[model samples]
Target: MTAGSRHSVSVAGVVVDDQGRALLIQRRDNGHWEAPGGVLELDEDILTGLRREVEEETGLQVTPTALTGVYKNMPRGIVALVFRCRAEAGSLRESDESSAFRWVTAEEVAKLADEAFAIRVQDALAQHLTAPIRQHDGLRILG
Candidate 1:
């Protein structure tokens, strides 16, 4: 790593329901719809961070079932670990980070979220032998 250059790790969970829909949160900060997650704490493990972030933003307890994808926002130096999760418990509530929530199908996800964020949900829903690694520039996925 170069001096003064560091990468931050974030964890996001795409909570899938029995109806094959993924849960998305409308971020209060930007009003953009995306998965519920945030920067992982230094003291916490991956799953712990995933559960905490999802719960904090959506008020739903989630159990991560698969590691779906790893995405890097090249411009921001943020690497995000995305997971396919099942809602284990709790009711949905709005939080400071999220203003609203929606359970959307794959088609709706594409329309509601940015390309970079929508792909993470799509990857989680697909069946993959291994997690996919991707790069983005905050809004668009890169080649």
Candidate 2:
């Protein structure tokens, strides 16, 4: 395949609390509210990258309990693996990647995040029998 045909992989975790709230981070670079995650390094294992990304952005050590969704940003050629995670340790704090953090209910997530990202968290919280596979253009989900 040509370089343009190559897709990058990213990992994200929707850190959920006991009350069923999910964590959202206001990204420092863009100020967009979304789940804590980033592109995976070439040598990194998926779960290790997920844990690193979540902790880097939200300052929380998380244990991924479920694979919630697989999303493709068609325009960007980015394929993201999203997981439902439980916070195992650490405290929430701001970092270079995130400006702020909030624990939001499922409804609040829809309002706070772009449609492309909001769906990821919703799928995680919904606890589907099979993970949803979806496509988007970065902001909106595709049909």
Candidate 3:
């Protein structure tokens, strides 16, 4: 959150269900659908950040099973840790940041995310077989 800093850390989830559909949220600010995630706190670890982000955004308790990738929001100069996770408990509820949520498959993620966030969704699907943690720079998906 500082000026001129080129790196910011965040954690996100690629939640899947029994049917293999992934969970996604419609961001309140831009109406773009994306995985549940948020910025990390000053003293928090990745796991804690992941759990808190998913819970706060979707009202779901997610325990990340695998890390899929690391993404850089180039425009904002922020870095994000992406994980393939599951909703261990809690029911889905729309929060201030998200207005809608749904369960979709790998194919459907493309529609929900469209072109802007295609890479993030692709990273999640690729992890379905082998979770590969990545670090890349690109246009901002959440911004």
Clashing pairs in 3: 22-104
Q: With candidate 1 superimposed using the best TM-score fit, by how many Å does residue 66's alpha carbon deviate from the native? A: 0.3
Better of 2 and 3 by lDDT: 2
Query: What are the per-residue Cα lDDT tens digits for candidate 2 across 25-67?
Result: 9999999999999999999999999999999998899999999
Runs in model 3 deviating more than 4 A are 1-3, 128-143
- Find the candidate with the highest TM-score and give its number: 2
* Cα RMSD (angstroms) for every candidate in the order listed: 1.0, 0.6, 3.5
User: Ten residues in a row with the worst lDDT in model 1?
Assistant: 120-129
RMSD of candidate 2 to true structure, Å: 0.6
On lDDT, who's better, 1 or 3? 1
Clashing pairs in 2: none
Q: What lDDT score belongs to each candidate, Candidate 1 first? A: 0.94, 0.96, 0.78
- Residue 99 local lDDT, model 2: 95
- Give the per-residue lDDT of model 3 (tens digit) for 4-53: 87567888888878777788899999898888888899899889989999
User: Model 1, which residues run further than 4 Å from truth?
Assistant: 1-3
Candidate order by decreasing lDDT: 2, 1, 3
**Model 3 Cα displacement at 30 (Å)?**
0.9
